[model samples]
Target: MAESEERRGLFSEEDEGDPAPDDQEGEPRTPLSPICDPSHLLHRIVVLAFMCFLGFGSYFCYDNPAALQTEVLQDMNLNTAEFMQLYAWYSWPNVVLCFLGGFLIDTVFGIRLGTIIFSLFVFGGQIVFATGAIVNHFWLMEVGRFIFGIGGESLAVAQNTYAVNWFKGKELNLVFGLQLSMARLGSTVNMNIMGWVYHEVGEVVAAGHTTLGVSLMLAAVTCLLSLFCALVLGALDKRAERILHKEQGKTGEVIKLTDVKDFPVSLWLIFIVCVGYYVAIFPFIGLGQVFFIEKFNFSPANARAVNSIVYIISAPASPVLGFMVDRVGRNVIWVLCAVVATLAAHMMLAFTFWNPWIAMSLLGLSYSLLACALWPMVAFVVPEHQLGTAYGFMQSIQNLGLALIAMAAGSILDTRGYLVLEVFFCACLCIALMAVVMLYFVDYLKGGDLNRSASERARLQKEAAAHSE
Candidate 1:
């Protein structure tokens, strides 16, 4: 009787004294909130830093050849056709290996092993290149460059995929911006340093003071620096992997190569866009020095010097556009980039005869805009698990387009002449504009709004309902 009275007293206090209800069966419970952790933030910063280093190495490899092209041709005693063929050969491996790299990164190595192995290839290729140049063997140098392309292409795929993994929805646009900006810095440094190197070496050769061996040594030193940077990156990647495993309680599966067949239509459209942009861009890079020399009557050194300005502009432009996209929306930034690129291409085609400086400025803006917009969009469309394969496939397609356009551009210049070259660039710009239109259409079809926030919210609500049930 006493125990019963105590229970009644507890119930009476809850029922009569307390304003809050004892049981509210119809009301929903608040979901658990996610807490921000310091470790996660640190991991992201480390990944970003590593990605910047990789960008620096990759761009160094890309721009190094351009700076040394004239010297290489002279040293090897190659004609214009042969030199162009060698350049084409260097790109062919990227066409082949880009997809393979992507699949392997996603399914096999993830970022850690993929990056390490590819770096070895880059280091080895540079060694071979040095040897070839020292021996004055053109074929050997071509072979070295082909090997380098394979590794370099893979490295590029890994870096982009890595960015997706580490950044994701948190500050992703900013990370991509910084990544691209660093790459442009690499290109700028390559142009400035390589120009100086070539000039110094050319003077030495002219004075009969040193052999081509000296230039080869310098190239080898840069390659070693790249390899060292890769090693540091690999160590950091392993640390990140450890942290991820501890946090997630499982290691993520690496992407496999065979998944290319399963890519969504959205990814395929992105691939097409990438191809169109690169096809227009790389050929222009290849021919820019030549054009400046022939059309503007500038010396090779002066032409290369002017070309450096484009890369210099790109270094800052990427980050600014990236920040804008992060704050606003990707679609807005993409459309803006497309508009700028279209205008720049048109300006170049129309006014190269009027003022080369204007054309050069337009070219710089075009490169900066496309780079900032196009690269980050991949992370938006592709799932994290498939990032490697998607990047690889896109790169392969892009490389193929670049190879074809470069060859055609060279041939047209040789056969049909400069008018055909102008026509080709104009056509490429138009195609790129179409790609931008298609992207907008796709976005509209997905929803009227460009931001995916509403969709994400809906998904979360569904998940919460499942958990409650």
Candidate 2:
């Protein structure tokens, strides 16, 4: 009860105001530095940039396998089963660990500390992966991926927590979209640049296995960049807390594990959309290089480019779509449209002989729109305190589906071929579409906050606060 009362009217303020009454005492507020002024938009944009790059290393290293799919297979002599394990190992552990990781963010490490630690996990894991590749040890690489996975998903939770803590009532959707853009930027870079990195390193390493490993080791540089960002962001957050007269430690609030059973049905529906939709995207991208090669009869180079199209387009499109959603003010409608567009893209890939460039471009734009619409809604359904746990649980489930479906995707491609795999992806999107429709109704019955325009939501919040007085 103390926690509940303390959390009231917290983390929702988007503009500068006085500290809590007890916080201010019988004294007037002190002047803030120009940099510390809450009204400073430039300072916030700088922070937003840091938040955007927080996932850079994780996204870059994740698609390393996909980027080097042909190379890893040929150089390491790995079959589809072994190659897919790289992704499976990374995702499988996150199924449970990331949920606990999120809880830890709320209870023990707090967001700043948890983020730093998780980034460290990602860095260390990638090193292990690069080492395994250099030495030609698949098992060691699996272990590296396992460690990387531990930090990767939890790092995302910490990122979400940071975003809500800072931008919850402001342009939260734009922040989420921008974050997705930077992360996808990481992925796009990996896809386009890693091949070049491999070729360059192959000169010294003389090609084959060590070239792949060395390239991955070079890829670890982005992880280092992200770690630096984390450290700087932590310092910034600490400084902001002091200057803003915001309370620390008590700020994260508590989210007990037992609270999961009480989460809203709307949140669960969103989770279904999360897992069902992404299993199609990520897994398809993981296996997509080969898919394009086989189905479209493209060269290896062209296939990699096509496989990268989603991230490339999304890198730019996500922020734009996000701004549109912010302006339009109907998140549910945007999500549904994104889902339908994705389904259409998949169906085109599955059945039509049309140019894949068109399909991939449409798919990328729709993906951006869905990401812009979907993620920030969690912040609305759950209280600020529960944000970490809620985001963690959602990611936990998504990784479970990724782990299982990635392997299945590999098998389907091997045995049933690319056509069957595309169909499988289509099926997952169909499930996501249905879930979005159900979410629409459920959110409606609960007063429609999720679908409300920015003005409407702000009006309702003000009324609720006034009534609580």
Candidate 3:
């Protein structure tokens, strides 16, 4: 009987020691596995489409003034110097509002509300512009342009944030490239179509018709289209929430300027590089057609068409550079772009009289290379949580450069002449070259290779493995 009792005790101990069968296998699997399944891929497509539509709206407002500058001067009875001042008025507000928009989107309102509010400003600004033009009120036109800049600057920030939300680590770089490419596509369209529109409007005004009324009507249509696209995006956001359960959840806490006290020095250098590069580029984009007209004696239509070619080339260049950044590495592509841009700038300044078409073509390629490479580098140096704020800060700096250069370029053209413009271009190129050299020094200090950083390559491999599992 004692033996039997001992055996029973042993059985009891074994039963207690054994893990539950289900526990051994694994915890009960959640039925909601694959939370971010591709079943809702259509929603992502819709969101991207809407983003492109918003892009169209922003570019239309930004590029229209350039296309219609001559007509605007005639209608407002302004001289060249006054028109240049007006252009400065239009461009400066973007610099001021970029930081505000970035902070508000990330912290206060979130993407949806931020997008809607700013879009309203865009619509309202268009209306104001139309009214000012119809009434022949030049000062009112300046007011409208300022308001439009405020709204338009936010569009880029909002769309960039949206891309990060839906596409992070999942072909994200390509999506970023596509989004930026679409924005350029919008710019190209505006440059081409606005030239025709301006010609038509000028003819109408010359025939004693009210061109402003017709232009205003067109603006109304575009604004309505933008609103409709934003609504579609809203619906897509809801669908994404259903599929992914708060699909666009906050990645992390909003990083304030104070919080960035310890941000890496390399990041600050990157910011400076971006600012100098944009300062050289954005203002030139505004003045490119004018430059062509002045330097080449091309008609307005031809000049605008030539200018559009840059963006047309850029549309493909962005995605190609993005893909290369992903495959080859970011640093390699960035350095190459900077070097190429430097060469192009020198070529343009030196050879403008050799063949204006050749100069313009090189300029276009230079713009494409720098733009595609520079913007994507933001993704590399900043933390994902801080990307929106970081980008906003970068853009703010960029706008500062743009605003100063636009004013400075115009003033130089007015006082010192076009030869001064060439000197300024050369100076800008040198600044850009210096920035690239700094980037190289930073890379060296980090013991990083420009061709291939082993750590990043390994990280990419790990990410690929995770996705596969």
Candidate 4:
């Protein structure tokens, strides 16, 4: 009895079952009618919306310096090397801490409270950042970024957990696609609109650090919005779990640090692929504005537009590609194709002076496709209890690579020209392409399950279940 109550407390801290009071002897309880029924599609969709927005604030604030690279330099009186440290600082701690964050999400805080706490950290960190900007203290701003980093990456893990929690087997691929779309949309909105917001803030505030700080301060509003979403989503999830009498997780199965030893080679290869591929995309975008201005002589507005194309295209393409991948079920094949396309895009950027719009557009489509197929593959290989840890390790590895490469890219830009930088990005993509090939062969040896169609996988799962029975 005590163990059962403890398990119940994981979903909600309150006492035994409290009646929902939705069916008050009136007009039947359909999906839309009750609006409170945990099993209803409407409730799940609402939860998914909040899940999308959960990462919006973090994603938006993450690229602030990227969008305003010039202004950050001018306002803080820093060079390119020092400016790149902003991203490095953000990525460095996430190297180790994100894994712990995931473990805590599984063991200590569960999903709901963990999310709220992380949201608060984001909100607080942004405030500190704005204060540093207002005071014109670069170190303070870096400290703020460090704090913000604590929440940002781990919050992503929590968001992923939420998606799996509510929508695991039903439209999960589409759900992941939509989540990535929304996160990238936040980034797109930041790049396009923050410049206008900066100018607007400049009109009222002083022009230098004051204006930059004020603009950054306003970003807190988005963090606040995310916090609200986290709170409401927690409440809704708790109620849903209670009403459905779901076991949030197996009470007896606890996460252990030693369990990582059990992870297969395929999962580690995915982590490497994530690290190899994204270092090219993200660090490039971080410094892309300057590359455009110098290499192509694009005006700042045009540079911002071209630089933002990847995210803009992702907003619509992710879901469509995700739905297609779901039907096709060759996730590894999709990943391979996406990596090859990305490699081609980087090659064009390196070898030609052709219109960057074409290169960026191709890159954008390729990234959307990779995102559609890559993440959900983890769910297939990992046990349900350890999904959080697997995701955390993936994020951590990716961040470590980003931290090192972002600093290197900045230094390379400072010393060598843009051409060399493009070559470097191309090389990273090559590594990604090779990793994907290796992953494919490895999974093929393990029954070719990774490349099988959805119907085939479903049939296999049923067979395995019957065999076990």
Clashes of each: 5, 0, 0, 0
Question: What is the clash count of model 4?
Answer: 0
All candidates' TM-scores? 0.74, 0.82, 0.79, 0.85
Residue-by-residue lDDT tens digits, candidate 4, 176-254: 6677778878889988888888999999988999999999999889999899999998898887765565644212223
**lDDT of every predicted structure (CA atoms):** 0.59, 0.79, 0.61, 0.79
For candidate 1, the lDDT comes to 0.59
lDDT of candidate 3? 0.61
Clashing pairs in 3: none
Error of 4 at 368 (Å): 1.8
Maximum-TM-score candidate = 4
| lDDT by residue for model 2 (165-228), tens | 6765446655765676677778888888888888889988778888988999999999988898
- Off-target runs (Cα >4 Å) in candidate 4 are 1-33, 36-47, 164-175, 235-255, 379-389, 443-447, 453-456
Model 3 bad stretches (over 4 Å): 1-38, 79-81, 85-87, 164-171, 203-217, 239-253, 330-333, 336-343, 346-351, 376-389, 449-456, 459-469
Please write out the lDDT profile of model 1 over residues 291-401, one tens digit for every residue: 667777878877777767777776776567545544555453465476556556545654566666666666676665565456555555656666545555666676677
Off by over 4 Å in 2: 1-51, 110-112, 160-177, 234-253, 376-389, 439-469
Model 3 CA lDDT for position 220: 54
* Cα deviation of 55, candidate 3, in Å: 2.0
